[model samples]
Target: MKRIFKFIENNFFVIVILFVAITLLYPNIFSWVLGKVHGINIMNLLLSIILFGMGTTLKFENFTEVFKKPKEIGVGLIAQYMIMPLLALTLAYIFKLDTALTAGLILVGTVPGGTASDVITFLAKGDLALSVSLTAISTVISPLLTPLITVLLIGNHIHFNPIEMFISIVQIVLIPIILGLLVNYKFPDFTENLKDYLPAVSSIVICLIIGGVLGANINSIYTASWIILVVIILQYFIGVALGFVVGYLSGMKMKQITTVAIELGFQNSGLSTSLAKTHFPNYPIATVPGALYSVWQNLAGSILAYLFRKYLNKEE
Candidate 1:
């Protein structure tokens, strides 16, 4: 058991890769698991558990980093909002994707930096604190900003009740995250010990979630395969380029640049998927980009983190 835990801890990225591979090979297993777990909103439960663990990791000080370095945070935020929506619009125009997919791609771009970015930033020897602050602020602001951005960019493409989206965000995104934050604040050591365990749990559940979504819509892959791959590739390069350019232009260090890159590249596609299901049920394909995104972003992020670490070491 100890060895298993340690193996998961040491090779979390490899585990994610393996999970993706398994899901691709045995896509039906996701449906099997979901069917067996009747009466459970497996996706929500997984997200709640993930957020609960995240809360334990939070510190009040992490939130304060924004106030101290407003400029850095501001630049990061600008890059996030700009790169995502613009890329989505451009890609949608170039490919002439359906409204649902266009909206999904836009939402993926608009959602802020997630907790996973913080882990990758740390792994890449980047600005861990800055990444944490950006992630916290982004998550906190997402309930408002994400919906507003979605409406502004894709409102014409779909019938979006902004009020409904707001409610969904509160139920799915805000409440769970806040509860997790409070849990961590009240019990520091307990949260710390559980940190190593939570990622593995979240990871396995995320894999399941991805597999379930893919299996359900395996048919979409036939027509949208090229489109999905294009969005994934474009989103990644744009994210990395935006991060590097913005960080350099803002006079940040190499480590800070890497942090920004990862933060921009890795999003909370899970959160976006939940939001789409709850509020944009009419546009089911809107969740596809995010679902496939969960798989692609992790693959790219792991490679980028490895490269950044090696490059940083060489420079040092």
Candidate 2:
């Protein structure tokens, strides 16, 4: 059982794609999670579970890692925020996406680097401390930055209230992370024991979120999928390319460059979907990009990790 769970955790990209395909083909199976009873989505609850699990992996030492090399962390955070969000806005206009799709893509851009990124960083032999620091700091500040960036990018294309969105992120993201951090901090021995299980649990939760999004918007996605798919893939590749260039220009080490590139390339798609669904319930299509992105980024990141491990890490 442990080995099976570890395999699922290690091969998360496969599990994610498989689950999303299931929901997209047979919406009824996972669509039930999308159904809101008294205005609460079981899907969002699943998202919280993932976020909390992410927190358990973190330690206060990870936060202190920021001070050890402030420049790399700064470069990573700047690259993280500037590269993806701007590209998302640009692609939204280039594709001439409608309001709902535009909003969804924008949300995808603005969220922080996810825990999957840390895993990819580890896999690629990148600077793991820098990756964890960036993920930690970006996630901590997301409640403020996410909504602010969303307002700047999406603007009038989507009806947005930063305050409402702020509260939603706080509830859906920040709180769960805090609780998980507390659990880890207060019960280090306990957290260590569960560390192996966390990846398996988180993989399942991410799939459920992906499944819910695909199931809910299966019809719209079938008809209108190509452009956003292009946009999401572009957003990732562009961020990665820009991350390498910027890291190189900034004189980051090869490992740091790979770390920055990976961090810039992936966003918190679960949080993006939760925000889209919670705040834009009327625009069901608004959650589509985040869902699709959730699938594509993992696949892309895994492939990237392999290439980086094979080629880039050899340089170090």
lDDT of each: 0.77, 0.87
**Per-prediction TM-score:** 0.91, 0.96
Residue ranges of candidate 2 with Cα displaced over 4 Å: 37-39
Which residue pairs clash in candidate 2?
none
lDDT of 1 by residue, 228-254 (tens): 888778877787888898898999888
Summarize candidate 2's per-residue lDDT along 216-242 as a digit string, tens digits. 788899889888899889998998899
TM-score of 2: 0.96
Instruction: Estimate the lDDT of model 1.
Output: 0.77
RMSD in angstroms between candidate 1 and the native structure over all alpha carbons: 2.3
Clashing pairs in 1: 55-180
RMSD, one per candidate, in order? 2.3, 1.4
Best lDDT goes to which candidate? 2
Among these predicted structures, which one has the highest TM-score? 2
